[model samples]
Target chain A: MVDVTAPPLSPTDRSTVRRHRDRQRADRAELHAVLDEALVAHVGRVVDGEPVVLPTLHARVGETLYLHGSSGAASLRGDEPVCVTVTIIDGLVYARRWFTQSANYRSAVVRGHARRVTDRDEALAAMRALVRQVAPGQEDHADPPSRKEMAATSIVALDLTEASVKARTGPPGDGDAVAAGDDRWAGVVGLATRVTGVTTCPALPEGTPVPAHVPTG
Target chain B: MVDVTAPPLSPTDRSTVRRHRDRQRADRAELHAVLDEALVAHVGRVVDGEPVVLPTLHARVGETLYLHGSSGAASLRGDEPVCVTVTIIDGLVYARRWFTQSANYRSAVVRGHARRVTDRDEALAAMRALVRQVAPGQEDHADPPSRKEMAATSIVALDLTEASVKARTGPPGDGDAVAAGDDRWAGVVGLATRVTGVTTCPALPEGTPVPAHVPTG
Candidate 1:
């Protein structure tokens, strides 16, 4: 096996940008991979001086992300600009001491305009991207959204500009007590999202065959 | 095993105060179990008319949650009120259609005053609680923070008042499509965080016994 400790790239790749190591990237590829795996993102915005963070499903296609909300959601449809952040905490970094302990995470902070998708084709495509993102093969099997459903939904696209990805991994910080002969164990504890099995909706027929796409993880 | 498909609890307990089904708890006990398992929370707050969401390590002891940050950090020191939300995405819900696909998540949203921790003993107890939150036994093994380190670190305590928990699970909502039958796969893909043992810092002396306080979740 490859030495996981061996640095994957130059030291610069892991250097922090804002709050030291807290604002650094372990690797560019690592960052993108985390983004690809997430199903939703927490979007924070200030609407009339109130800060609101809304958790909604999202899809990242190329350099842009698409999020959908009800047409009546004030924060989604509000005119104020927003800052969108997508984070995937892969593991908990547990070091010897409290100060040195941190989370092993991949996060992208995006500051951009929240544009409404008015074009029918563009809006539909964004929705498709979101569906595919949450469950990879979902779009082909189900009935397309009815005109009424489409009318009720509002999609917003945020351009992925002025964004920075930050992450941290390994035993602990370089200069921590753990490195200075502190007799303590230091590593990570991982967590995962699991699908137990397919759940037939009560409204479905008694003998309905479970669609392959509907199977639980 | 219990029939998870059966209704988990009363409608009131299963629903949010806001009465959003999409944000309601399908399994009440499951929601509490998820929240009790984690130690860190990403708090969303407004700073200087802008939305700033900061990732702070936290500990939950009963109904109270303890959070710490640098006193010099503008957001934590400022007098403005803050909204702290603790979320654990249990699974990814895959619906037959793209629109119904969503995340199976458990989250607690708390709105309260972000008060600073000034008492020395209370601050220490909060730090210990936070360490034990993630790693159950490590707080006793680690050395206490020195006076200088204590002054440098900024800790905040947020009461869990005005809070609500919500969650969703199982397959996506396909309704009539599943009843009539469709030839498409629809299912969830499980993603998990896996810890792969401890990695010793290069600066550590050879053969130091690993402390028992390291978290293994």
Candidate 2:
């Protein structure tokens, strides 16, 4: 097992416990499960007194969350501390009122020190792990990163020690104000993920077999 | 029909051109289609030197994109320039190399001035439009926001005057540099936006026919 530790999958003392509506169950199991289901997360950070939030690919191994970006990413430089938030919106909640409009989502926020991944071995491993996680059995199919290529990209690994996962599932909430009346059409708009048939590049010659993983729904 | 000028479907300036794979057609079309299909966008902005990105409901009426948040949102307070990025991950692009691992996503980055919606009538219309945009038949079902409630919330409308969209789709790029001799199972792990059956609130007594527009897909 990875030498990772998090608050008892619940709220932690060092963590900020917001309202239950905004907080997800803290258990590692819940966090890991959602992370595995999600393909990417919106990463947020501040740079030069400006905020830049980039959508990047990420993966979780044990208790460590890994993020990959081009070395040219302005916000990832070693000058300041960063707050990273990863959110996976599972579905959309379509309520009658504007205020009640929300999402059926699972999100994890980590406030921690961000450092460049200098160890090449660890970076390579992390990258490979992320690759496999995103697409199972992809590591072997992919050409390993060349040293020059590896240097061109940057990877940051943050411990999931001080993080909280908050989620709101099911229909819209039943606040006192909202509960007073029940005539409105309140429900969720299911967002289904669909994969088109294998699309081939025009440049590629004919006869390429579609990989088994790219299933058409 | 709604007297709302729909923002131009795509950006005009050459700067809106995608830098990475400049020739991909699906990338461009997907960007606009994704934004049009979804009702809410995760808006990212900075406040007081801290980066905060919130998943708020959004609407695109013609070229102008509008977003509304609570008056309490720290990021929505100031008029400073901000980068608003809207992203929709269509599918997961699983590749053969760890470095090539990426998501098939559509994203638009709009760099411009954000103006606060101070006019009460416009704010109310924008808020109603936003809700209706997300759940097409919702505005009529729910009670309108009371004056106090409207005052409690802050609705900001930002023009999509200058923006660029970048999109990546299909299978992972075949890394020509590393594709010579390596052979492993390579493909994309697809994701779908599924709409699970609706679970009515306990407050909503049984058997209220699921609203037609409230999709059960």
Candidate 3:
């Protein structure tokens, strides 16, 4: 339905998709939705002339994206050119042929220099957003970070100025094969991220009531 | 329980995890397990010196991992250095403090020069593997790709030679806070990839008997 075609939004050439331009969504809201729906992001940066990609938890606050990592993590330090991408696998498309078989997915790719959040207030807000991003009401239930804990955590913020979203939806791409009288079965097997269960900590008392804020199966 | 800390399998200096050594799993099996369980992977490569990461479909065959893309996708062309990373979020950990809150996840990172699959047999095998990876029984159900279809597809093989896996499980990291008499509730909200539904192609007549192989909600 993204007609840049009507939702036109990407500013940079590199952020735009060359192939399957039809799947590209330039809407800023579409960009934010892709980042917010997923729990993890694959962060990449050139390390010694080679690209290194690592998966980490991410949170989005308006145009800013914050990635969570350890203070000792080398990739998270310093302002460096980076790419952060998140994908939500919607379904597996079983088409008439292997070439046409595909997955229905929504993915967002953000490229920019990542800067460590140095200001205490900004860092505090980002930290709260990170916790809330993963488990909504749990942010209020969890204690605020202590001074020592903050020292051990690293929060790097990357602006979402240059970003693009690509998504493929609906049935198999080769419906014409059926029109050609191919009897082969074709359909989509949907996939989703689900909460399987809530397991309490062993150290906590056995009857420790499961918090209402936590997602349960 | 990956004890190199016992499974010690990383051969290169960069593949080793400097932080959270306890979470790094060196077993080859662990790396394979992480790749097989996830439906999508984030592929990263250096483009004009800045790193670029995009999500795509992938299938693993023994020591080789195959990434599928359109023939026109520039990033998938030529032999280039890449980092393929996949993350399976096991659960959301709600800890006593924001600092201690974390995700229970298993992730794998593989780095190598991806070479195009030119040989027809290898390409065909990789294509079948790719289909089966997403939906097991569909490989047999779907028709094999024709010559023109093969020309429009690209399969790149990257060796699993340089790779590492990291996983975190069990209760929250801060059980001592409970011992300190903090009334805050803390536990794990498990997450999993699930099949939500099956939708047949719209072009095909409705009430077409659903196949047995596709995963369903």
Candidate 4:
């Protein structure tokens, strides 16, 4: 519903960080990058005057983020304000001082009132996009959602008009005193989500090789 | 301050899931496992009447979750209600039908009003636990937080009373129709947080070997 096309990264009143403003990435491209790399997002919504955060799969189609869950899901049902966050932890920063220790990560937060997709055509397209984002090339291979399946699922579309992206990369920025002292090691241990192996279903005939598109390390 | 020691997983008014109740893990040990494996938590707080979620390093100390941030961080400053969620994406489930696709993940959510830890000793211990959780042996090598550093950091503790843990592992549970048709691969691609390498600080002396505890694939 919100038209945010190539808009400059302008922080809204809520998006501004009171601390660590240096780490805030105001570039719109940065927000897109974080959303693209993430397969799941933690969505926060107010339930009964209390905040509830739930993890769910998400996909970005242009300026809108589509989050799908069972139609019966209480959190995704109503048209309420929601905050979706995607975080990619890149590494752990080991600092010389305990207070300075931190994680190297790229995170994006989008705040908007979710609009449940009701148009059948739009819902199908959003579902396809979600499939493509999670497992590339599978949309064409897998059967499309049936009428019953479509009716049973709820897809909420959130516009990226108001969003914030913050990232901290590279080595730990030790303080002057810790940098001067050379008693211990100080660096980053790179962390990544690696596809260790592909597992075929037991129902599948034996020797069915994993498709090339399936990610495998 | 909530004493929820190994109580039965009674669904709080806000913690009940209307969809996919089978995925909910009721055991307290399951909650602890998810918290232990997670390095970061997406913390949600109501800021200016809008839900805001931020990613931060977190450590578990028995029944409490300690989240530290810059004392100046507006989101961490107040004793407002907060919801902290830890999610671990274990794999990507490839189902035969697009509608059945889901991620294999373990997620835990804790909802409570954050209590700012002003006690110097408790704050110090929390900081040390945080350091040890992220980079195990590094805590022994690194200097403790100085008085100024301690004063600059803010630690918020959330009790584990009203919490929910949900996990979905193993293969994709395709419907009867989808399972009967075996044209495409149907299983989960195991994903893991792999330590690709360690980037040591240039400040270190020449030829300083990477520490053994520093994770390396």
- Give the runs in model 3 whose Cα sits over 4 Å from its true position: A1-8, B1-8
Best DockQ among the predictions, by candidate number: 3
Give the number of the best model, judged by lDDT.
Answer: 3
Model 3, position A153, has a per-residue lDDT of 77
Against the true structure, whose TM-score is highest? 3
Candidate ordering by TM-score (highest first): 3, 4, 2, 1
Model 2, runs deviating above 4 Å: A1-4, A8-25, A73-79, A174-184, A192-217, B1-34, B73-75, B175-190
lDDT of 3 by residue, B50-108 (tens): 99998888999888999985566456774999999999999999888898889999999
Q: Over the stretch B1-217, how does candidate 4's per-residue lDDT look in tens digits?
A: 6445677554586776566789888788899999988988999887667677878889999888999755664667648788999999998888888987878999999999889898899898888889988899888878898888887788889988888888888777873543555656777889989998888876777567777777767
Error of 2 at B97 (Å): 2.4
Q: Write the per-residue lDDT of candidate 3 for residues A82-186, one digit (tens) a residue.
A: 999999998889898888889999999989999988888888899999999999987788888888878777889998888899999999989998788976678
lDDT of each: 0.62, 0.64, 0.86, 0.83
Error of 4 at B129 (Å): 1.1
Docking class of 3: medium
Candidate 2 per-residue lDDT, tens place, A1-217, comes to 5434444653444345444435547577777777777666666676556555666677787878788755453436433444556666667776656667767777666655666788889888878877876666667766679988798778887777766677788777643444576555566666645664454433344555656654646
| TM accuracy, model 4 | 0.94
The order by descending lDDT is: 3, 4, 2, 1
- Candidate 3 chain A has its poorest 10 consecutive residues by lDDT at A1-10
Give stretches of model 1 more than 4 Å off.
A1-17, A26-32, A73-75, A174-181, A190-217, B1-19, B22-34, B72-75, B183-197, B202-217
